[model samples]
Target: MGSPNEMVYIVDDDSTVCDALSSLLRANGKNVRLFSSGAEFLSFERGDVGACLILDLRMPGMDGLEVQKLVSNQASIPVIFVTGQGNVPSTVRAMKGGAVDFLTKPIDEAVLLAAVEHALEKDRIARCEALQQADLLARYHLLTPREREVLPLLVSGLLNKQAAWELGITEYTVQIHRGNIMRKMKADSFARLVKLAGKLKS
Candidate 1:
């Protein structure tokens, strides 16, 4: 069974295929959303929810690859492509676009289920990273201008006296700022503070 909050979105033009996939996923304690075309799926607002998309490679209006490109820049929902007439070129393009998996028509239920689980796990990890980054940024914004000035020098392996001289402040003032930065960033050690700075810089 997949996570209750995690959804599996299915976008295929064939009604029978969509229905069968939806039922199978739902029966296995997974949430499912079925779309008849890529456009319909794109129109839905999926903001920060952990989910994976099962997209058909060929469809009218907009194809799966087109949708994948668009979403890759947005929320980056993990994609698993399902195609009735998949070709080498198409599969290569999908893989390059960060697709989780590609399955041909008449896909085995076991294979499809495994792919969906993998995609959902990818989404979960991405969501966690996003949340952690947001938290780090929020903490960083709480820093004072002087603290911000001290941070780079501290992380760059500068001694307190050197950082104070660079910032035209007393060594005692630099130590005070360092303590504040550590407390505000919730970093327990000098190494952890350096790591947090790296994440912020990246």
Candidate 2:
């Protein structure tokens, strides 16, 4: 079974190529979308989900590399470049630009499916990490100015008294801010708070 929430996008100028690739992916229980050109593909707004692009390397206008550039900022959609004749230069460029795989036509069914599976999984993990980063940022935004200042100090293993001295605040007040930081960050333990802080810094 496959979830429609996971999509496979095919962008090829040739209708025959598009139809064949779409059929193969659909047979594998994947939801497929087709486009005649990179412009068409980029214009369509995509939803947040697990998805990947099967891009034809050569096109009449705005080739695969151009499309890859357009979508480079979007981490949710991983890419696989398929060319009539895949070359070393193109393959190297695609890999450097973060394509999951570089494929040539007439493509092998098993290899294409494998690459698609890997791409879907990559997209899944990327989306998950992005969601987690967003959640962490939201939580961090809820902290007060003083709480924000104390977060790094306490996470750096400073004693409350030491932190109080650094900030020129009473230890009692530092303890109160520490409690607020713990609650605001929704951290169950100091270790978890430290981990969250590390993620934010990274």
Number of the top-ranking candidate, with lDDT as the measure: 1
After superposition, candidate 1 runs with Cα above 4 Å error: none
**Candidate 1 C-alpha error for residue 43, in Å:** 1.0
Worst 10 residues of 2 by lDDT: 69-78
Listed in order, each prediction's TM-score against the native is: 0.97, 0.96
Give the per-residue lDDT of model 2 (tens digit) for 1-202: 4577999999999999999999999999999999999999989988876899999999998999999988886544789999998889989999999999998889999999999999999988888898999999999999999999999999999999999999999999999999999998999999999999999988
Q: Please list the C-alpha lDDT of all candidates, in the order they appear.
A: 0.93, 0.92
TM-score of 2: 0.96
Q: What C-alpha lDDT, on a 0 to 100 scale, does residue 40 get in candidate 1?
A: 88
Q: Model 1, poorest ten-residue lDDT window?
A: 41-50
